[model samples]
Target: MNPQASAQRGSFRHRLVRKKRMANSNEHNAAGYLFIAPWLIGFFLLTLWPIVRSFYLSFTEYSLLEDPTWVGLGNYSEILFKDELFRTSLGVTFTFVVFSVPVKLFCSLMVAMALNKSIRGINFYRTAIYFPSLIGGSIAVSVLWRNMFDLNGYINHVLGWFHIKGVGWLTNPDTSLGTLVLLNAWQFGSTMVIFLAGLKQIPQDLYESAAVDGAGKVRRFFNITLPMLSPVMFFNLVLGVIGSFQMFTSAFVITNGGPVNSTYMYALFLFEKAFKNYQMGYASALAWILLVIIAALTAINFLMSKYWVFYESEGGRAK
Candidate 1:
């Protein structure tokens, strides 16, 4: 063949291959979209759309029964400046977060340490410990908790067996919040599992070396185990804070914001504003305010994590 004809033939073959490649890419893209279509549909319809609509509605006064009336900053102004219940609920939520997160984390960590041991019947023990987390937030547990804290419930009944008078745990303002905190603490099963996993990842050689250096259990935990587990602890701390802040079911079912509003969580307050009083706009505003609070706290955790959270991959130096 002539030289020009040879070059032309080569160019034609290149274009043919490019077209075939493009066709395969298109097929793959179509298949991927097909596979993900359900998730995409649910995300937009169930999650994203509702989020955007609620944000828009936050500035409007709407009863679900009527067209939304735009109110600009009126709802926010009222929540921040005029609403006494908002402040009370926020205080209660803050108190819960402060108490519940630490207690839950402590219980989780201690239980995790216990479960990390190579003991007989360990699997059964894990299942038993973790079972409560599966139904910890359910209405059933909340109702049971309500009865258990009632003046004549199982807890008081048991106390009576000891010849001790059981005060009204859920009815007294001083003790109502404590019951909720204890309930929250009881749900440490999930956190404990995560902590157990983290514990398994820690190198036993480190503990052995610490023991060689005359470090007791307490010192080894503080210097070696704690430093090694700091990243996991940071993760658990952030999650605990967020979850405690949003606790609703227990307070709603057990206390109903009673006992002088001692257990009035922010979520319960939002629920009443939206469902009970039909203040949809107010509730939306409250939701966004909650988002901002959670975001700010999460940001703070991330910022402070640099000081404490240790990673082994930071070039042999603490990160």
Candidate 2:
């Protein structure tokens, strides 16, 4: 056989093998897309379309009963300039975030540290503590919380033992917001779980070394645990801030944003505009404003995180 012919035959076979592999790769890709088609369709139809539609609706005058008329920035202008309720709601939301996020994070970290210890039935204790998170956001729980804080309710009954008379927690203007903040703290179970997971990742040797260096518990926690936990704390802080800004269920069901609108949260305001007044356009604008506020805060958090979020792998603050 000619050497040239042999080379030509080998080249042809190589091309054929390459073509076969390419065909198989294409088939695999097609099958993968087919498997994810449902998710893609659901995302577009249920999630993305609504988001786009709402953004479009935000620039119009929509009352749900009438066809939406294009108003450009009219809705946003009105909400920003003419809406007193919007300002009140925004102020209330800011206050809620300021009070709730720190309290929730502190409670979560404290509870997580306590539960991180090894003891008999520790698992049971963790489960019991975490169980509230499963049902914490439900309407039933909000109603129960309302009743518990009522003037003649469970909280007052409990306080009576100590001769401390309870005020109308959800009804008073001064205390209504505080009650909601307390409720937000009560839902710290999920945050505690995240903190606990982060705590577990920290090396035991670090604590032992600190102890050997004559560091007391307070000093050790501030110097060791906090730096190690800073990354987790940053994560929880961002989530807590976002969630607190959108807080609604308890405020709506418990206080109804009442007592001179003292607890008139942004979410409750958005809900009332969209549903009660059927002002979809105004509501959409409010929603976008809230989104921007959250985005701004999250961006600030990311920018500031480099100063505090110490990554163990990086051996210092995250770059």
Candidate 3:
């Protein structure tokens, strides 16, 4: 064939192939959208709609049975100035978050670090540590916690061995919050798993090099491991703080928010207002307040992370 004829034939074939490829690409894109359509629809309906509705309801008096009444900032003013329980609940929740998040993160990070080392029966140890988190927030676990903290329960029984008399863990206002804080700390396995994943992602070469430079385990941990794991630590810290702020199930089941509302978290307060007292408007306001608090705290965390959290690309060499 002549060169011109050959060139024309090649161009025709290339155009046909391109057209066929484009047609296949369109079919694949359509199929991907079809696969995700249900999820998109459900997300919009269930999550987005409810969020928008809640934001709207926060500005109104919206009882379940009655039409919403435009209340402006009345709910906020009422809760801020008049409602004593709101302040108390917020105080309790803040205390819990402050105590629980740090303690839980520490416990989880320690456990993860231990598990990261070569040890006998490691799988068994990991399973044992992780099992508690699985059942930590269950009704059955709550019930068990209630019993264990009761005056005459197993805690006292164990205390008898040390000749130490047990105080009221669940009943005493001073001790009740402490008991829940401990419970929250004990369920550190989920965070531990995340830390373990972060640890595994850390290259062994970093540690080996640190060791070569005569850095002890503690030195290496402070200098290398902690900085490298800061991202995961920050993630768990935020989640733990949020979860602690909304703590309800344990308090609800174990203490019912008291001997004197000592263990009442924000979620329990909101629940009581919404359902038990039938103060839906007040509860919605409380929910919005909680969201604002969480958002503020999360924002603060992100801001502080800029100072403390060392990402790999941010002049921190992760081997």
Put down candidate 2 lDDT per residue, 1-319, tens digits, no spaces.
9999999998888567545334444667778889999999999999999899999999998997889999999999999999999999999999999999999899889999999898789889888888878888999999898889889998999999999988988889999999888878888899999999999988898899989999999998999899999999999999999989988888888888999999999999999999999999889989999999999999999999998888877865343
What 10-residue stretch in candidate 3 is worst by lDDT?
17-26
Cα displacement (Å) at residue 65, model 3: 2.1
lDDT of 3 by residue, 1-319 (tens): 9999999998898667545334454667778889999999999999899888877777788767889898988888999999888989899988888888888898999989989988899999999999999999899999999899889999999999999999989999999999999988889999999999999998898899989999998999999899889999999989888878878899899998897989888899899888988766677888888888899999999999998898998686534
Best candidate according to TM-score: 3
How many residue pairs collide in each prediction?
0, 0, 0
291: Cα error in model 1, Å: 0.4
lDDT per residue for candidate 1 within 1-319, as digits (tens), equals 9999999998888567555334444667778989999999999999999999999999999999999999999999999999999999999999999999999899999999999999999999999999989998899999888888899888999998899998899999999999999998988999999999999999888899889999999999998888889989999999999988898888988889988999999999999999999999989999999999999999999999998888888744343
TM-scores for all candidates: the values are 0.87, 0.87, 0.89
| Candidate with best lDDT | 1
- Superpose all Cα atoms of candidate 3 onto the true structure and report the RMSD in Å to 1 decimal: 8.1
Q: lDDT of each prediction vs. the true structure?
A: 0.92, 0.91, 0.89
Weakest 10 consecutive residues of candidate 1 by summed lDDT: 17-26
Report model 1's TM-score to 2 decimal places. 0.87
